[model samples]
Target chain A: MNKEIGPIEDLIKKLNRLPGIGSKTAQRLAYHIIEMEDVEVADLANSIIRAKKDTKQCSICMNYADSDPCEICSNNSRDDSIICVVESPKDVEAMERSLSFRGKYHVLHGVISPLKGKTAEDVTINQLLKRIENGNVKEVIVATNPTVDGDTTARYIQNILEKYDDLIISRIGYGLPVGGDLEYYDEITISTAIQNRRKLD
Target chain B: MNKEIGPIEDLIKKLNRLPGIGSKTAQRLAYHIIEMEDVEVADLANSIIRAKKDTKQCSICMNYADSDPCEICSNNSRDDSIICVVESPKDVEAMERSLSFRGKYHVLHGVISPLKGKTAEDVTINQLLKRIENGNVKEVIVATNPTVDGDTTARYIQNILEKYDDLIISRIGYGLPVGGDLEYYDEITISTAIQNRRKLD
Candidate 1:
């Protein structure tokens, strides 16, 4: 019945475009949507539109926010001397979830991926360098993911920031995840975790 | 940062309501939604709203459709005398994908299950009986899923349909799925497949 170009089919196609969603999942989502109240469905639709329109790129950290400087950048308690550099706003959320870092963040919006034709210019590399060169920032933490692009991006940023004599650039270590089984870890992860083993307090 | 009831957080909550979407998946979908063009995301939202607004239950078969009687029920190409009974709209889509059934469908919207407190009154059993009695229907195919609930529903329908001496009521066979491995099939499937084996041409 949905083989026709009806609204249900259209919704399915649109839902399938989201990451990790396939045709089957999209279909299920569409059916579930039909079951929801009209007001609730409208709220969902309006939420998406409002999120895009109201959320701006934070001038300091480049994280998406309703305010210009963002909550993190404006917070006086957060350390201004230390800045954690990440690939995206989602990474900022991940770091925040850990609740360990009480410093500022710089969102690159993406990593350096040669395969995808993304280079330093494509990301916020120049802005990161400018922040360091402006002085007062003591340490820079490269908190990119463990993927090839993330590592490449981290290395590239480190190389550039090394020119600033007072700036100390460090990388977030790749280690066995907390509570992860050693036997289940991949070879590369195990080796890296071993190589970057930290001294126990 | 998104722990706040911000736009991103709101979108995540909305996304999590969809079937099979957990909090993590919802977050991923929310981020993906932000990456998408405003027009595209708006289209997805509007499509869901439009689908619910436009599609109505067909009076005859009780399937969701743009108009009463639905396309299949009105189409002369479809076999009017033979009706396939299914639990949901998705099941009708599955049957249509096979292109095997030219006959129309009757969507009960749910299956009979005592655990869930569903009874003959809960589903469209009366409508199905009325359709058969009012029309010149020759046979009824029970195409509910192969779950415990599906089997229970099929058996209940069969018991009631027995009163109509002229109508033939049949259940779709339970067997090893075509191209499925014999070694991996459960005992019930293997046994049922053997018993339901038919004469080949």
Candidate 2:
């Protein structure tokens, strides 16, 4: 008694499961896929499969890569002495987009959140510590998101690395974006930026 | 000298090619895929490839299906005598969701559009005619969208099938949708409803 034409419905259901895609959007996308040339559709599908199958996390930085050591980690030109610690691969991408960081990255995968039952132990923090302990790392920059969990995770990492007093550790500053007005910026961002403000010499 | 990570950028670019997915959304989704559990991400990737590889147009109705005839077309209980013609497989789904039609469907895949260079020959109109000529079909309901191309396609099909006067060919009537407001309704929709007004008798 099910009236739906089977394969199309199955595809829509699958598309709906993707993050941020709703039922209507899924339906639209399904229709678009069907309308596409067979080769184009097949290529799209193949790309998705290949992306998942061929990629893996770098053993060192935990960023997605085609090999054990990601391109960034293995690159000879990168500053191996400085590690930019971030919450996710997207944060790594964001930092890379800025073209400011020449140092390598360590992807935490997630930040500490008691509410979400995620602690420092649950993430790649141990791997990061191992990397630092193994060699000539001079600095660790905590570039996690400017959220509660991010701050907590950063603090935890700082406390753990405190034993290595010879190593320098810094945090990326939080504030209203360059073009953003103070009035439009959230209260927490304003307060955090003010609290963490550094004096000019 | 491209500061961007190659594979990550390529993945984001590929994701942006999907309908309605912008750069930011694509980046977010790409990152999400990167962060997902290996099995779950693999499943998503596999689903996309499987959908493309396994699905094809039902030879009879031109709707998407794994089988040549499609489940609906092959099903004995469906009213094969009455063919509800629609623009795409999604339209068939919408009709099914309403639970209003018991007949089998003929998906045109697209409507006639001179602007888009989509002629009657480009769609499955010939296949539909061939089905009707095979002789068991009693009625053909033109259920295309209420757009100009939709109406033109319906009219074109009606004209083409006019030779078979013995067959009953009809277009679904235009009316204000349930819970839709008259004031907010488009002029074309309201005008069409008025022009196609039904007689209660």
Candidate 3:
């Protein structure tokens, strides 16, 4: 049985509710929290509350933002003519870190996984269709993950976007990661990479 | 530039302040927090605040408690005459789990580590002395972790407690853990275990 007080026990219970955190991790984190200074603990609490309350969805791209149109959606420097669709806001951050994609983004929030109870309507596919309906977007890049669900979602979106006569639809390529060793790569990944091999420029 | 808005960025900063948590984990946790329901997020926030505000040191054992005396200190069933001295509340929880020591506890909060600027005076060593003085404490068990700092602190406490004519002072044994193979045991640990080996029935 745990020896922590009622409040500490309750804190552990609350922490355990988060995804990927188990009872042991929650208890450990709670113990660590109590050792911190009072002001720091208060700041942690304030940040959680603030993030929940302050963040809103970008009207255009559906990415999380402090304002209606997210930082990317509002910024005129980004290439609005090209829209990249991803699975979550975290993906948006990853793309931003690369500084490679200068275009805007549409967050699907999740891929369509029938087994996981996720359907086409659950994501922001409809919003994306409406956003690019005027044909201002010259190309649409489906940058979902390489998982089975991600592939299926990308294909589903591709089929719909193919209706636009002038819209150029593309999916990010599958290949061995830059730093990954060839010996460690799985059979399916190697085969897929070989099948999609391109001519060296 | 970070893609997340002000509150999300602030939350990531605050989360990064936690021990053992890095920038990537903080960002992942922040993204997870933002996606949670408002009430669940509020509960998590409230738990942190309440644990910080409500948890106080037990007057007797110095463990975190909702009340001053704490559950273990006030429980008459425990052997008050056997005072088990430990380094933290977490240690108390671990000892309790073992079910071997059904006694009272003294929390030192830290070991006397000169490198970390911790002295004998920094922990509750003085309070322990005062509590055991002219009292019914039959034996004092030093259950500090088996580290360089912990061993030094235990020896120092033992030297002082030895002055008492009738009091029995004991250090928890140094031996291979239960179910551990001697082949993988370090030299120091194997030698110590051999030196302290008991006569089997």
Candidate 4:
């Protein structure tokens, strides 16, 4: 029995489960948590719970929101005819941060990856197709990530939407480095990448 | 108004408040939280709240505990006569890892630092003196950090305990680097440093 760890070991284990947080980082964070004021620590905990509890996927665009339609979906100023579909809410945020994309967003929650056992059905592609079929959407920009899975998912969606010839189907530019996660890229690169997007033949 | 930030910014702000987590790290963590399973995210949040709510200071020694006396203090096999005084619960965990000392512990919560506006009264020095006054403690081992502030606090405690002729007062040795933190030091170094402690007088 590693009696040395005691209660703190349990705390480190919990923290280590967080994404990108290794054991060493977890230990540092756990020590910091123990040193924090009870109220401060409690508030941090509450925020996590609140974010999970309050946020839901938008019914129309699939972006995260407190309401089903989401603030962006419900808003009147957004370009209703242009829907930018992406892999996750983080991607939606990345696009929005550029201050250039005024269209609405559709968050797929994930991409099609057979290697990871993720199929097209596993993502929100069906919901996206339903939205496209409903009408008034002039353009459907596939803003999925630059990964193999993202590209595959984008192609699959484009093929499905090709049946609706009246709608313009386009993919976001691919200047973003292959295999680079979108969340780490800056606003300028993402904006330039978006503006220079190529039309898929 | 930066509508792109919206609710995501709130999550990032909360994450940044955590110790050692900067804005970039906080953003990464917030995005990760969004990506995680709702159950896993909830568990992490609940752990934070539970750790803060369920844990408290041991009334006798001031070490963090789920119960008043703490497990070490309440344990029958442990030597209650030797109280290993440390700056925080993290220190207590360090000593416990060594398994070199089979005695109880008293967490001071902080050390004396006038530059940071922390004084002797700010720490648990009075409680320590009171514990010593109970007459059961034969040795009070000051295992506080080895920093300048730690040294000052240890000296201050030694000065206060000088009035009591019946009890033996000792500070952990200073072979630890002058400016280094105790939390990062290894078990062997800490154990050797403690075993080699010399008399202050």
Top DockQ: which candidate number? 1
User: How would you encode candidate 1's per-residue C-alpha lDDT over A33-141 as one tens digit per residue?
Assistant: 8888989888888888877777788888888887888999999998999988888787777667655578899999888999999999999888877877674898887
Give lDDT tens digits, candidate 2, residues A1-201.
Answer: 666445566777877887999888887887777667778776666566566667778999998877788889999999999999999887887899899999989999889999999877889999999999997999999998887888899999999999997899999977878888889888898997799788999
Predicted candidate 1 versus true structure: per-residue lDDT over B1-201, tens digit per residue: 436588888888887877799987888777777778878877777787788888777999998877787888899989999999999989998999999999989999899999999998999999999998899999999999888999999999999999999899999878989899999989988998999999999
What is the per-residue lDDT of model 4 for residues B101-171, given as tens digits with 9 covering 90 to 100?
Answer: 99888888899998999998999999988888874888888998877898899899889988888778888
Deviation of model 4 at A165, angstroms? 4.1
Model number with the top lDDT? 3
Error of 2 at B36 (Å): 5.2
Query: Which whole-number lDDT from 0 to 100 does residue A196 have in model 3?
Result: 86
Off by over 4 Å in 4: A1-16, A21-49, A162-168, B1-12, B22-50, B162-201
By DockQ rank, best first, the candidates go 1, 3, 4, 2
- Candidate 1: segments with Cα more than 4 A from true spot: A1-4, A176-201, B1-4
Better of 1 and 3 by DockQ: 1
Q: Relative to the unseen true structure, what is the C-alpha lDDT of residue A20 in candidate 4, on a scale of 0 to 100? A: 77
Q: Which has the better DockQ: candidate 2, or candidate 3?
A: 3
Task: Give the alpha carbon lDDT tens digit for every residue of A140-183 in model 4.
Answer: 88888888898999899888888776788888876688888776
**Which candidate ranks first by TM-score, i.e. highest?**
1
Report the interface RMSD that candidate 2 achieves against the true structure, in angstroms.
2.5
**Cα deviation of B178 in candidate 4 (Å)?**
19
